[model samples]
Target: MKKRRRDLIQLSILVVLGAAVILSLVLPQLPGRGRELQPLELSVIFREADTALWSNTRLGMEQAAGDLGAELRFLTLTRTGDGAEQTELLRREADGGAGALVVVPADPENLKLQLSETVGSCPVVSIESPLEGAGLVVAPDNEALGRELAEAVLEDWRGGMVLLLDTAVGSTGVAARLDGAEAVLTAAGVPVFRQTAAPGRLAAGLRVLSSVQKAEAIMAFDPYATEQTIRAVEAGGLGQLVYGVGVSTYVVGALERGSAAAVAAWSDYAAGYLAAEGAIRLARGEAYTAEELPFTVVRGEDIYEADNQKLLFPVTS
Candidate 1:
């Protein structure tokens, strides 16, 4: 009897030990591991151009990095949009031995090639605009955004001319949004007037807005472009006739003033935060995938409220 009892106790101890080993292996996969998250180093390289937007994005990234106890390096190659400058910065960071890199390349074509040669072995992620064959990418569903914008236009104006404002025709993000918008509009048998702006010219957006003969709505690809269109329409005394669709504080203000009809905005803060998270995951020798943060469409009275202010990144405004 004594021998049997001792055997039973030993077997129970073995079972408990086995269970603990299994738990340790599966705990990280469970939600909120709550382990003392390790500190990580991440380099964020912005495109030489879009300084203001990059700054805003960096703020979010920094905040997230701080929360996650990670070190962040935010660098810009030039004040103006220069692909060569961005390429040089990427090369430098790679040589400096960063744990991970989050880059917004200036020129997709040239930067893609340079990145392939320079940072090919490193864990690199892209946001806003994706680099082809990147390890990770964070961007809105451009097609979905486009469809949402088109539907917003249809809701306000059923049969009038709708103008689509894009920064560049070849830009992957812009092209995707345009394609999505076009699909929805075509399905509804609505005509779309699309125009591409000159590189780095807000005036080009205004020019398109001014040139529209019977414009019912204007959908801008970015916040800055949206602001320019609003200014142009207001100056031309066409604010009442034209509806704007954009994502930014300025666009929200426009909506409050009844100038912008709707704005589809992604969480810049969340993207920045997630970018930092991805960097840390990469640093931990863990494989990670690109992901998109949640997005919201702000319009009507919600644009002016304090609660709705979350839509705008803290860094931008």
Candidate 2:
């Protein structure tokens, strides 16, 4: 009888130990399995000091951030066309623990090192102009844009003098477009002249116009430059010039006024939307690739068309 009692006690102890082991394993998955993820905060910095270009990009980013339930901090460098100042602002944002960064570097090449440093701990996406070492770049294919502009000019004007107006020499977008224009113009046996505008000088347009000996077409690379060129051309009695092309709202307005032959524009809203989406994906440990937004050509006659208008500003369209 005592032996039987001893066996029962041994069985009871084994059952208790087994129950304890099972409880330890099951308790961990009960109501607390993994650590909760912290809410993400994203920062977007615009290179342009003025908020003129910020409108569409801001609208897209705000909408995307809202839909994704993420916090967004909008920061501006407050100076137009200053690369150094923009880089400083990016460093500050990154040091402050922003989970992701979206930047439009004023100078892509000069700002690459600084941008890479800032983006080391977080994802960095670029709009309009791309920098090296960026997580994702969102812009139009500038070479394609340039080629299209050149083709348009060549088709309309037959082998007459043509001048190309570029804002800066070192910009990737400007260089790409310039190369494309050069290739097309050369292939068509069209004589081409190239000129550079001073940084932030509207009077450069007047200077360029004065220097042109005889040109049937003037291709302005930027929208504001195109507008200034139109004013200068009109002032100099060169309104008879066949074609003017550029990129900008002012240029679009010039097209509306019959001053421009064609304008190439990528959806600023789509750029912003892509940047925001890229940031969110990075924050969530997801993968994304560099994206090139499509471009649209706005002609003088189609400037007011609904489809063209949609390309000008993407958010509302």
Candidate 3:
């Protein structure tokens, strides 16, 4: 009888132990007991100063940071395309304990080297342009953007001289765009003349070029260049149809005014969101598949269409 009683007690204890073990495994995943993740500090470094051009992108990033329970800091270079400045900022952020970083590299080659030495184990994501060593790159296919802009120009093109405005002349992004544009225009047998200049001075260069060479159509590779072309065309009374990439108030206004022919733009907002999300994922050691960013060509006639408006103007509230 005593032996049987002891065995019964032992079995009762074993059953209780099993039940406790099962509860331990299940309780953490229960509705009210889910694990809480601490917010991470993320830093975003831009190649240039903050401007209206970045508003939509910034909004998207801010929203993502909020949604993902992360802190975000935005830093920009005082001078555009200052690779050294960008590199220094990267070092500073990493040393300052930034959980992750998103960069728009001003000089990819130099930054690529710097990133290897400076960032240690922190994850990095790049946007706008490519940095070879970044953990991820979130940007539209720049070459495709250029091709679409070229096609837009050819829609009404009767073929004369088409001027290719090379804004930010030496950038990898711009170079890719130029390649795509040139390929399309050359294949069509359109006479293409190229002009290279910095963003702020592109309009002046355009005016000077127009004085000596008459072109039937102008293709600007970036927002500032496109806006400058519109201003140069309108203020100088030069009658050249303009097409380009990017969206800003100036570019959109030009489109509405019919001074600009067409603009190729992607959801910069989406680019921003993806960059933030990627940084967080990489930081957490989570696996991520890069999302493809698609582009759209907006013309004056369809600028107000719901889809285009959603891209150009997002409801950040």
Top candidate (lDDT):
3
Candidate 2 worst ten-residue window by lDDT: 239-248
Question: Which of the predicted structures, 2 or 3, would earn the higher lDDT when compared with the native?
Answer: 3
How well does each candidate superpose onto the true structure, as a TM-score? 0.75, 0.77, 0.83
Q: Considering lDDT, where higher is better, how would the candidates rank from best to worst?
A: 3, 2, 1
* Residue 299 local lDDT, model 2: 79
Question: lDDT tens string, model 3, 1-317?
Answer: 99999999999999999999999999888874642444789998886664567777788888889888889998988876677888899989999999999987777888788788888799999887777778898877889888888888778899688988776643577678878989998899888988766666556655776432578888887665677678878887787888888889888888899888898988888888889888998898898767668989999998999999988887777
**Mind sharing the TM-score for model 2?**
0.77
Better structure of 1 and 2 per TM-score: 2
Model 1, span 1-317: residue lDDT tens: 99999999999999999999999999877774643454566888875455565455677788877776778887876544466777788778887887788886556677688777887566777776777756778887877887887777777775676777765453576577777877887788877777766435553446444546566676776655666677777766665333433355566667777877777777776677777777777766688776565566677677546655656635342
Which stretches of model 1 miss by more than 4 angstroms? 1-41, 48-50, 54-56, 77-81, 208-210, 240-246, 304-307, 313-317
All candidates in order of TM-score, best leading:
3, 2, 1
- Stretch of 10 with least lDDT, candidate 1: 239-248
Alpha-carbon shift of residue 124 in model 3 (angstroms): 1.2
Global CA lDDT of candidate 2, please? Answer: 0.71
Cα displacement (Å) at residue 269, model 3: 1.2
Per-residue lDDT of 309 in model 3: 93
